[model samples]
Target: MRRTHSLRTRLAFGYGLFFAAVLVLMSAGVYWLVRQALLTEVSQELAAAAELIQQDFAASAGPLPGFFSDPDVLLKSLPPRLTELDTPAFYVQVSDLDDQFSIGSASLRGQQLPRTPEDQTAAMGGSTTTRIFPLGRGRVIQLSAPLLAGGAVVGVLQVAQSLRPVDQTLQVLLEGLAITGLIALVAAVRGGVWIVSRSLGPVNEITSTARQIFQAADLARRVPAASAADEIGALADTINAMLERLESLFTAQRRFVADVSHELRTPLTAMRGHLELLQRGVVRDAEDQAEMTADLLREVNRLTRMANDLLLLAQAEVGLQLRCAPVALDDLVLEVVRELRPLGEGVAMRPQLAEQVAISGDRDRIKQALINLVANAIQHSPVDGTVTVALDQDGESAYLRVRDEGQGIAPEDLSHVFERFYRADRARAQRTGGAGLGLAIVQWVAHAHGGEVLVESALGSGAAFIIRLPLSREQETEDRG
Candidate 1:
């Protein structure tokens, strides 16, 4: 198995590594600059010393041969600082044109400084050269220049200085940089961890809340809000909204199951009672037996209707597909009104329709929707009241309205009238043998046909349910043109 590190650890480690790389590069650059500056200073001093020695040699001796002829006189011409027995400033050496050692500074203590062939050749060519090489217990910077007599190269003057002081300064700087970098790296890693953890704190809280909800099977719980409105906060808000929707859906599902069970139980109980009465021969008269059989048939038909309505609702919830064809809206309205007029009993049914209003939709589904609306309106109409079915059209859409003279829906119940199995008056709905799914089916049919259903009602007044469906494309085009 591959091991994974936490985001906080990864971020902190990355931050520390980046800082370390920058620190190392900066330290290396600083060390290089300082070392170069010190070496340049020493080289400058060596050049100056060599120049002064040459001037003294030219002043004290008349010619190059005479200068090399006497070692004691040459020694006397050297700088006093170079001759000091206690901690001399520099080591000096002189060599003749033949590459023979001629004289040396007292600081050398009779010790001859080693000369490289390169330095000797440069001196012979009259080109001054400087180099740094290891000596005794430390290092030194040496400058070699040609000695001139009568403007001719006669000998070589070499000057060198110890680099112990510069080394000590650089060593201290390296130690300081190392210690400071280590401390800063540690601080940076810790700070990065803290910042990353704080930023992801809300994510952890949301995860914990979701875990609890899953374990407890409770969708009511929500993720806590974050302190700041950043990306994490937005995520928290989104999760809470999802939880709210899930809770609503779950609540509706439970209610739908209960409503379906009750609706089924009522018919089943009545049918069973009637079947037992007939089976026991309690209805000896043919008329009584026939009535009991009719009651059982009625219950069965009600159950079948409820089952079909439930199936239609299920299809609507998944996504209902319609068979498209040109449908005459006025003719469909008139047919539905004629079929349902007898069911209204004492209530009058009226059809106020416009002419030549057609739509593109499934004919059967449109008729079913019109039938549901007219039936619902007739069921709700008062005794001897009028149930008006009206159809009208505009440039883009057709309107089908079903109005009934009855006690209108309350303000609070109007919004939820199209919800499955919802009834404002449960007792009245039961007395009428309604499953309370008619309005829902009507709403779904309207939506499937690219339309919407709206209701307008007030207390003690009648209610008007209007369905608005888009007109057929060809009809709309012709009208527009």
Candidate 2:
């Protein structure tokens, strides 16, 4: 379904409607003001004309005789002078009280205006008044005033002006206003659309870029960033950041898969070779068969260890499931030191255990991390050199520091020590039969406990790996309690 209007259309329509309404109201107000002014001027002019006509009748005929008593005298004398005074814009009329006798401008000579309610009201001693009525293909403003003689009204005088010219003027004004309003409305709509389009252009670009990337199945593609400090710019930046993260994640995933495949294939290849040899009966004797079986078992164990390490790392990546408890840092460090001391061979295991050092964490994970660090130290330390396992605490944190006296990590390899399967030296890696995931696991365990593993070393100077964890609040509370 064509569910809704586009944003541009909606914006333009709403803006245009608002502008049009404002223009209409403005035009209406202007038209009303102009009409009022024109009509008021016409009424005032008509009043003045009516006054002058009464004066002309009273001066010219009232003194000569029965002008006040006879209606015919005032009617006859009024039209000629009124006609001479009349211009094309306005006309005059005189009528008796009975409304039967009337005389007016030449246009009204044969045409008789009706005795409207306003005219009768004027004749009945009301104040002077004005009214509008249609007359002969046009409209007129009619003002009625009483014609008085000896303090009594004998007749009514009306002055009317055709409103054609004024109406034409108003019509022209209306047309101009309408034209201007239309122009303004069009301009406003166009301008609003243009502005809205420009403002939304970035969002459109993001959408287009997203569609392109989705179609191409390319995580590396990104929306172009904008410098504008607007919401659109922010959205673009956010999308770009998301794309970057996705690209990084996918790249890492691919590399991880390749690495795992290569690593697992080695053991699988060895096991297959030995199995095929056994199937082909290539073993020369019982000793050879036993040796081959031992080799196969070794490969199997290696594969199993690698698989287990990968599982742990994968779980850590998502969020390691750790069983939490309060563990003594000093006790864990001493325990790891004791377990690793017998395996050190020519290397000496040293302990610098601090008292009452504790933390809240998974004890087994913490112990595993400590063992990994000490084992790594044992592997790296030179003959007769000391591998020191130390535990201490400051105000807010507990720390376990393991230092190995050996050729330390090179500067270039130091940063990558905790990366999966990263070996500082390949020869040592082969000699030690270590998978290089020990430090990585240690780092993971530290982070899982909301702590961090920090390393400091220099070539030939030895390396120190520090596991820092938050102090156990329970320990403090128990002591206080």
Candidate 3:
């Protein structure tokens, strides 16, 4: 299935989201710290301005204009201009019960300020108060103090300052944070996207390799391995392993088809030739007809036996059997030799038996393997030639050697002797009714026992076929472990 996800986009989004959240939280903390510091400075300045207005009102001792003072007389005592004030950079405005005055504002020609009876009473009753003033386009903080007349309420002393300094400082901080935040976000997103792309590149290569393989057909594709020591490299290795197995299986299947067809063609041609001659009335007598039928039946039997052997070899190679308990190798070998004694007729037989030789195996399959090997040796030996069957056991393993004084295999054909349907001589194969699966089955048997079959021979010398098996159940277990 195809998916609609981009590694670059996903990486960028993840980094942007997480770091964006952190930036917001950190920015909020910074803003809170800045606000507290600004408020502390403003509070100190407000307290100072309130103390200055209180001193001016105490010197005058004027009556408040209204119950909630108009701040009229408080303004008159204030200086007409604030050019000589301690904080000339600030706009110092004043108001009390008598009048209002703007000492330093270039923009506040007529700005009404906040004043209430509660605020006035709070300020006059031995306390100070503060409030906010909303001018048209700006804002200010105002603090009020009380003027005492013989320990009773006289008038309020008001002092106000414009909020420009705090606003300017906050504006500068906001601009810097915005720029820094944008730059950091850009760098983080770029790095994350690049990393994700590089990491996912191998995945794309895997997809491309997979696409090269055919669907429901022949196998001929190889996955390329990346030269990295990472998880992606491990994935490449696994894919390559699977592809190798598939290629081997396909090659074996092809070779099996060709070999089977080639082996069957000769027997089938002989049976057809015999049948054609019998049908043409050349075999007019009953004995001749019976001989023709026997030839046909022999070829059919040969075909069936070869098919069965190939099937057994295939099953063994594929490991299709379950294991069982220990097999007494000595008894098994002697029994197999007795069974094949009839086939060893006309050839002198000698048997050397071993005792107490046990190995883990399947009894019937192992017997079938030995039967094929002994039969092959007897059939190939000369009349009155010696066929010796010997069994020996060692500390680790058991060995069965079948020796025959026959024409030894050619050096070139010896290596391929165990291959399916491979015959050393076509003339010998015709006389023995052989399809060449006997030794193949023996090889698989050796492989199943976790051992091997060794064929020792020279050009004119007799051949000896050696079969090796595990010694005992304990030995097999130790080998496996």
Score every model by TM-score. Answer: 0.69, 0.66, 0.59
In model 3, pairs of residues that clash are 71-96, 71-97, 71-99, 72-97, 72-98, 72-99, 73-98, 73-99
Best by TM-score: 1
Q: Encode model 2's per-residue lDDT on 1-481: one tens digit a residue.
A: 7789888789889988898899999999999999999988888878887787777666555544556356666656663567676676576777777776776677574676666776678667747878788988899888888876545676787878889989999999999998998898889899999998998788788889999999999987789888888888888888889889999888878877776787778778888999999999988799999999998888777777777878888888887688987787777777777777789999988899667777878998888888888888898888999999888877677889999998998999988899877888877875666777788899988888788999999998999999989888976665556
Q: Residue-wise lDDT of candidate 3 within 1-481, one digit each (tens)?
A: 8888676687779888998888878877897799779867887887875666456545554454442343454445444333334353344444444444323244345444566787777865778777776655666776767755445655555556767777888889888888898888788778877887888888888877687665534356666788888888899888878888889877878888887887789789989899898878787899988988998998999999988887777677677674657787678777877788888778877778855567888787777778887888898899989888888866687898988899988899889899877889878887988888899888888888788899999877988999998776686565557
Q: Return the candidate ranking by lDDT, descending.
A: 1, 2, 3
In candidate 1, how many Å is residue 438 off? 1.5
Best-matching candidate per lDDT: 1
lDDT of each: 0.85, 0.81, 0.74
lDDT of 2: 0.81
Error of 1 at 40 (Å): 13
- Compared with the true structure, model 3 gives a TM-score of 0.59
Q: Where does candidate 1 have its weakest 10-residue lDDT segment?
A: 78-87
CA lDDT for candidate 1: 0.85
RMSD of 3: 8.9
- Give the residue spans of candidate 2 off by over 4 A: 17-179, 278-291, 476-481
Candidate 3 at 452: error in angstroms? 4.6
lDDT of 3: 0.74
RMSD of 1: 6.3
- Which pairs, if any, clash in model 1? none
